[model samples]
Target: MRQKARDLFEKLGYRKIMMAGMLLTGIILYGFLLDSVQSDTYDIQLFQLSQETIRSEKTVEDPVKTELERQRLTEEVAPSYQFMSEIVDNQTALVASIFGYILEVKAPPEQEEDRLTKEEMIEKLREDLRLLETSDNGLRLTDDMLSSLLSLSEARLLNVQKELNNLLESSLNESIRVEEVARYRTEIEQEIRRNETIPNDIIQAAVTIGRFGIIANEVVNEELTAKQVEQIRNSVEPTRILQGQVLVQEGQVIDREVYRQLELAGMTEERLNYKPLLGLFIFVIIAVGLLFIVISRSKKDDEHKITEMLVVMVATSISLILMKLLSAISNNFDLVISFFFPTALAGMLVCLLVNERAAVYVTIFVSAAAGLMLPSGYSATLQVDVAFYILFGGLTAIYLIDRVGGRGRLLHISLAVAFANALFVAFYLLLGQTQYSWSEIAFYFSAAVVSGLLSGALAIGFLPFFESAFGMLSTMRLIELSNPNHPLLKKILMETPGTYHHSLMVANLADASCEAIGANGLLARVGCYYHDIGKTKYPQFFIENQVNIENPHDRLPPEKSRDIILAHGIQGAQMLKKHKMPKEIIDVAAQHHGTSLLKFFYYKAKETNPDVDENTYRYEGPKPQTKEIAIISIADSLEAAVRSMKEPTSEKIKKLVDSIVEDKLKDGQFEECDISLKELKKVKEVMCDTLNGIFHSRIEYPKETN
Candidate 1:
């Protein structure tokens, strides 16, 4: 049952379930912002006293007032008109057609011998006028007017036509509008009536025909007037309610403009609004995408960091919960408490334990999350200033923390973060419109400084627990363990000086190779210091510690020598585990040798016995499972191999390092670890250079001492 639980625990590492919890955690994180993002609801109606100060959350145009302005401007514009000269021509043509038909009946131009009688003439005129009325030329003359024109002597008829033409021409001089059409027609009737030269029947006939020909000279241009009204509409700018504009101050009555602005800004929206939920989903998706990109870039690393990544979620949650709590407290008490939020805390932790890339991702997420909260001043919730401040400050901490040496560096990191935070706040002040007194300004900068300092202090306090809980080692911890005076190092040195010196040489080789391949060099160096601790128990038997003494291994059987040599891996692991060392370091000690063959012992045993089991000559092993340990394994073997050489040169060192790495490749030693061929190639190059430096030829020195 215990083994089963261990299997289950190891199964849940970060890279094992990267996608499984990302969306769920992201959604949970989004839930924390829903209430903060939602616009505040109010009990006060129009004309009521305000319970608190309320500001607009966004800018919006006033549609009703805008429409009213457009209507008033449209009325003030003068109507347009166009001179339709075609109307005058059409009316004049109709009058001419009427008189021409009357002349044809009264006296035919042919003057036939059987001349038509007056009754015949009148009847003929009427028939022709009826035909004319049905055609395009409109006939306007009445029956009385037609009969009178037929009865007129030839002289009187000519005079009446001349008088009507003059009167029609005079009326057109003014280019009559529709309103003047009636008066013009009446004046035409009076002109004929005043003529005593014409008979009463003629006057009546002229007046009837004149009224029919009268029409308005000009018409309204609908298209032009419409375009003018549109221009007026466009010219009127809309009245807007700007974001963060104070809608109603505390205890002020909700007047017309105030209430209208509140409604426009959505502060008066219904209680169960979906906008907040929609916004939360979008923001959560963005945060999830950021983390997904970060972890997805290194699949091998993420698989092992599962439980450690969950701790990342815990760190993020603390930041989110604290920011929300502080924002609420600040809102309630009218204090700028958000200035005291240690926004960089999560970023520092992620950069230290995981990586800078993942820390940067957390920085962006936290920055955005900080903005989507009930802001400090009862103003806009999603403050751009707040988001940018946290963003730059957190990123600053992440990069700086990468160079941290030990706990002593925490103070410098704190000062740097505090200065960064204060600088950002000052930047916001220069650009923002809000007025702040020097005392308030001092308070704000002080809070920001405290915020920065708190980030460093909290990270130090939380780091140990994270390291222990995750079974991981931080760089600071590695540095502390690497000290020459460490109890473990001193014990190994005094008990077995040869083994200690060999351990230090292996540490130098492994650290350089690990760094060349972007692995943990500090951990590799520290792991090397403890890798051979088991050699202390049987110091004289090991060749390194045997010094000039007689070889104990020469008398022992091949199997016994092999057994004693293999015991160190197991014993060193047990010793480190007893001391509660990091699992990573314990793994380096336990798995560095990795089931390799003891060829000399195996061959000697084979010569003595015909059929000996070769398995007994091999170390019982679990192979290196990480890049750092895998590098150390190669360094350990290569360091020992080169140290045993009679005369090492640069070419010989390179050749031997390549040979060992190639043998490890063929022996499948790197199969269990995630080290790639490319990285392994780089590791060999760095090791060869380090080995050449250690074994380089020197010039012969004179006997100056004598």
Candidate 2:
């Protein structure tokens, strides 16, 4: 049954599987995030004119209106207060501390050699007050408050403290709420003036100190306030509409009270809200439709890489999940925290692992979904600014990752992204009509920088996981394989030193040519390094590795020699597959020769017997199945053919490269791949330039005259 199922899956083809995948993606999106992306379906809102009259189905408590009434009652109830005797005591101590400081400044100790200056005393007193701010006394005195108190005579300062203490005892015996502190302060000033024994010189200063010391000691009693609220909520009966109540007449405006009644009676147009459900359907269609078009039009090579589709689908799902999580966080903060989302992570992953061009379109689909995950509930209107910001940032990431060369250049890419993200955020914030506070502007700016850095960090972090799980070949993986120390690369260098240098030359040629025609140059370069791995097993048999030895093939029949040459291509493929190398590298190794006639051995065989067949002297090949391999095939032959030339010149090399390309074209080696004639022309030009440079002649030193 399992084998049958696997066979059926293949028979259904990529198009059908893609359709099913798209459908599943849509369903998952709708199932999880429908509330965020659904539209304003019913068109019902407060204060709108009703086009049709709505009647109550049955009489019930109008919860909306009743709740409003209860809230009004709760608001009207004055907050109860509790006067604390301990607050009065603390204030008395703090006031006493101020007078003590004043008396100490008035008369320093006789035993001290140096008397403290008034300025120093005042400074000390000020520092003491600041320290007191942290204590239970919670006293905070200003410079004016401290200096004025210290300026008074020691005797007068003591009298002022006594007066303040008595006044607090008399006044705070009653309640003093924050709102009525002013009224009580005025009464205390009158009481102080009536005391004739107190000197008049410090009266104004004492009044200032008295007023400064006073605070609202009677704090609100939360227990009493909550009890009062509960009573109001319980006492207020729910408002009700009659069974036959006309909640709204035709063309009647939905005022607050009338709208509440209509809503309570389930007569609002949203009672049967189907538009959100329908909107979800349309939303899914648009998102999935974009993916379908993008994947369908990609390189023909992608049709076989079904894993690429699955990887992209999973990446898309991850992006949606990130948006949903960000929405949840944003709702809590009531801020658009999506500004900090790592929008470029998915784009960078797809660009490196899959097609860079397709990554841009996939990102657009993700960004469109991002706009749907808005702050507003369920009536999702796409936030044009957010969508635009995400789309541009994602596109920038794809461009940088695709075009930029070295790992060291990544920091430069991150900095570039940071600048773009910050600029985009600032531009949008400034351009919008709503006046955002400087703090809000700072928040968004910081989030943008963080967003850019996070994209790089997250892309780096998740790259290894995705590559391991999917066994996908990325540019980084290709670079790693290109290292000289890799076991397979070292094997060729040790066992087949001549073939190793030949492979390196082919790599240089293939890299330049593939890049000229907008193909994956890195893949071609790395593939070329391992393309001749089988020659390691029979290093001495091939001409390039025949150092200081007689040609072994000279001792064998032409038929036997052809078989040895033919076995190398097949053996290299098996060896690479055994080492678990990427399929793309294996393809290049297996198809670089492309079943072309082996003229050297075939002509030699033809001299011996007229009946010798041409088919017997060819490499068994699947042909070049991609542009990279096709270019490699051409470069492989061109490098060998040019190296064998005697006293090669630039003009001779160009003609030679052109002839090699035409020979491959005539033999139909490129028929299985998608390489075009125009691209081939560019490839020929690149090969000619590279070959000429490699074989350029230099002026010889004047023959050792000594």
The numbered model that scores best in lDDT is 1
lDDT of 2 by residue, 126-182 (tens): 666666666543555656666667777777777778988888777877788888888
TM-score each candidate: 0.83, 0.60
What lDDT score is found at residue 645 in candidate 1? 95
Once superposed on the true structure, which residue ranges of model 1 sit more than 4 Å away at CA?
1-6, 9-16, 45-49, 97-176, 179-214, 227-239, 248-265, 299-302, 333-336, 374-381, 490-497, 538-564, 598-617, 662-668, 676-678, 700-706
Residue pairs in candidate 2 whose N, alpha carbon or C atoms collide under 3 angstroms: none
Mind giving the per-residue lDDT tens digits that candidate 1 earns over 1-706?
4355357657775544667768667877877877777767676688899988887776779887888889999999987988876776666666777777777776665657868887777777778678656754255666666777888877777787777777777787567888888898898888879977768877878887777677777778899999999999999999777777788899998898788778777777576767667877887887877777676664446544565466678778878888877876774554466778886898988877777788888888888888876375444457777788788889888878757667768778888889999998898777779898898888889988998999988988988988866665776678778888889889999999988999999999999998888888888999999999988879898878877799998899988899898899999999999888888888989999887888888999999996999888877778888888889888888888888998999888889988999988888888998999999989988998888888889989988885
Model 2 alpha-carbon miss at residue 4, Å: 9.7
Each model's Cα RMSD: 4.8, 25.3
Alpha-carbon RMSD, candidate 1: 4.8
Supply every candidate's count of residue pairs whose N, Cα or C atoms clash at under 3 angstroms: 5, 0
lDDT for model 2: 0.79
